[model samples]
Target: MIDARGPEFAQVLERCTVLLGTLFQTRNDILVFPGVGTGGLEAAVVNTLSPGDPILVATSGVFGDRFARLAEAFGVDVRRLSIPRGRAVEPEQLQEALEENSDVLAVLLTHSEPSTGVTNPLAELAPLVRERGHLLIVDAVSALGAVPAQTDELGLDVVIGGSQRAWHMEPGLVMLSVSERAWDASKRARLPRFYWDWRHAKNTPDRFLAPYMPALGLFYPLENGLHEIDEEGLPRVWERHRRLGAFVRAGVIARGLQLFADPAYASNTLTTFKVPDDLDAGALRERLAETHGVLLGEGQAELAGRLLRIAHLGYTSEDEMRSTLDAIQLAIAAERADDPT
Candidate 1:
């Protein structure tokens, strides 16, 4: 207990959190909470929005819909713009939505579309939201630390990310950066909150972390992860993720599979592929893991049995991706031979 709140540890935590913000180039203050990325999602909502505030959700896939549902649970007036599962929400589309929803208080968007493997245009969409004078909140649970997110430059009001994805930490830690505009919104926000309160400890003079029980152990690993990212250099890390994404896409294409998401907006952390004709998605994944020891991402609700996903992020090398590709190829070949048709 003392270790978690001591001045030395507090300084270390502050340094690490700030480093995480640097990865996004944000100058905003950060709030570290104990929970999953969903907690950060809720915090972003409750901390800055009243129950009746009309907010727009730009959704394309499973996680995006999940966030919209979370907002609905909080009683927010959620208006969702549903893009097709494999495509991104363009800036023009957002502009049109905002124009139509003149009373929109904020726009909730997922930075990296993990379920469908599309990376929404954050850099472009930022100005669009700013131009319309609405707050911007992003779910970057699987995007941060592996992709480019210029929080300050993009003028995002609240940016939410998790420790598990690119930080490679065990789950239950969610990080948030709240801009000044969001802080102002918090003061007027009417949503009920206690443990998720952002102002209590965040602005306190000597507070080490949050005002409540914190995920104390994650701070140490978070510091180490930030150090690793710093040592590797951000640009190099970003480039590595890009190359890995391309490699996986090429691998799937060489296997005669179609990519689910448009290549122009594909995410660097994950890639989605359409289920091959007459092939069972789940069985294909099972055969890959059982016979070749290669594990692939399972599909979400509607996408289930219709597509498969390949996900990788942080510290992964080319050889590992090659291994995954080889395993998938062999699995497919076996599945084909077994089927009579």
Candidate 2:
């Protein structure tokens, strides 16, 4: 319903929320704004709780670690549950953390840790937070469409999504859903917030649509992306990701490469592998892109020189999978040839 002249941003925002709800399988409305998944996280923290509020963070990777830092920046009291990089935090550990921190107002969790390719057990973990009288907020940016997330059924208080990871779109906009639990908490939060504030944006439509200009063109492609998911169905989409993940993992093992994450906790959307000591993943990534036209993501931070990531999400095909394997084989062979010791 966007016209070139009148209230295009308003109409686009309306459609955007519907498309996001469909993508995330949520009944609540989604907010659209500048920045990617990180922006959505900021909004959730700034609006839903106040300074000095006790927050419990479950971190298994770099992105999860960011939640702790951001919460601290807002002057919130943070109790952290840090797990090994390649392993998911157990439900028992989370339960213990909550037990020890009885004053925790909220719990932050990451659904999929793309950095280490680990998937947390949110379904099992949410109930613990609820039982302890704490709100659960999930950073499901990578898991949202790529993996299955039933937000309402899981009792998640807030969930965040993005366009780049699973939606197969540009990275400017982030989508977030606020549950009734979070809505009630926001009533008493006294945090200083402006662009990331949810009060005015949630209660007043004009405030949401006025100064904040909507990304109109992104809406068109997001609609297309949601339609693609609808056509395939969420179950089929999840099955495809799992199948592809297995295919890629099998290929890596066949080539004698070591997997970074444990088999049971590994993410189905992405697979991280420890680069063979004989090979340089950075150079191999460049060669694969230049020689084979296959673009793969490199590792980050502490994992930089050690791991390589395969992103098998969103409109991914089996043919592309085969091509990627072939390209990786070529890179491995080339590396082995250079130093056949």
Candidate 3:
């Protein structure tokens, strides 16, 4: 049914409406979706930058790390400000990194690092980028909807979002924003692209917002989700994420687990904690799910097995967080009883 060309066009417009609402929420102009999250990142790197263009990439966790890798993949010269996991990048460090790269075209960073449960200071980062006359590209995929971003005031040139996160929609749909500077840079960049050309997508209204036909069925659910956020009020939805995150973190600390992130910078969508060195983190996750039917996220890279992530995002509530914490404590106690060392 969706394969029909006529219906696909209308659905594509619906997709655009949903995307425009999400991107505009960040307060940026000219939203684009080269493909999805990764595609949006690629387009940012390829379209707005020439090979060997200087750029500063702020890396705190997995997504920020991906930004550096993607920049290098497009042959852009990358200068990294390596903030340690669980910490936000200070403005002073960004100043130092920028001073070292005088020709920087853009500064890339994640608004929220889902892997490390760290939310960086994008409000601070954006102005610094603007002061240096460099565009700020934000990976707000996990931050948008779940977090509050005043895109216009922040001076961010490009912002990215994915449908799977707080948007509460199916994957495959992605959102992006482009500013005037980013659009101007497109003229000189020589990256090989086909379906990802933003100029083409922007010009050809008939082909929909993207160069290719998208997942049309996703628009139906995505529209519903966006409308739900609109009705609830975006700020109120963000407040829900904030309050639940704090409640969960408080409960985790109450249960005697060490929080992995600084409370000031802790992501309002999720929290991570270091399992007591004596406890097996992997076993803790399993018993919680098998015994209590509660699923939680695990850490990545160096944090794997050392930490466990607790998500308080996406249609979750305070009661749910309390129950999740209760289950976690039970799981740990059960694991200790079965094998005490």
Q: Which candidate achieves the best TM-score against the true structure?
A: 1
Per-residue CA lDDT of model 1 for 1-341, tens digit only, reads 45665677678767876787787678788788888898899898888889888999999888899999999999999999999889999988988888889799999999998888999988888898888889999998888989987888889989998888755677777888899999999999999998788875483335555556567787788888888888888899899999999998988898888999999999989888998888899899999888887778878888888888888788878899889878877887889899958
RMSD of 1: 1.5
Number of the top-ranking candidate, with lDDT as the measure: 1
Least accurate 10 contiguous residues by lDDT in model 3: 26-35
1 or 2, greater by lDDT: 1
| Per-residue accuracy of model 3 over 1-341 as CA lDDT, tens digit each | 65634655556564655555553564334444424688778877877787888888999988888889988988889999988888988888888888888688888988989888999988877787898788788888887778876676776787777767645677777767776777777777787775667675562334544346656666667677777777788778878888888888899999988899888999988899998888888888888889999888888887788889887777987888889999888888888999999
Q: What is the lDDT of residue 341 in candidate 2?
A: 82
Off by over 4 Å in 2: 1-9, 203-211
Backbone clashes in model 2, listed as residue pairs? none
C-alpha lDDT of all candidate models, in order: 0.85, 0.81, 0.78
The true-versus-predicted C-alpha distance at residue 122 of model 3, in Å, is 0.8
Give the local distance difference test score of model 3: 0.78
Q: Please give the range of 10 consecutive residues that has the lowest summed lDDT in model 1.
A: 203-212
Which is the better candidate, 2 or 3, if ranked by lDDT?
2
Query: In terms of TM-score, how similar is model 1 to the real structure?
Result: 0.96
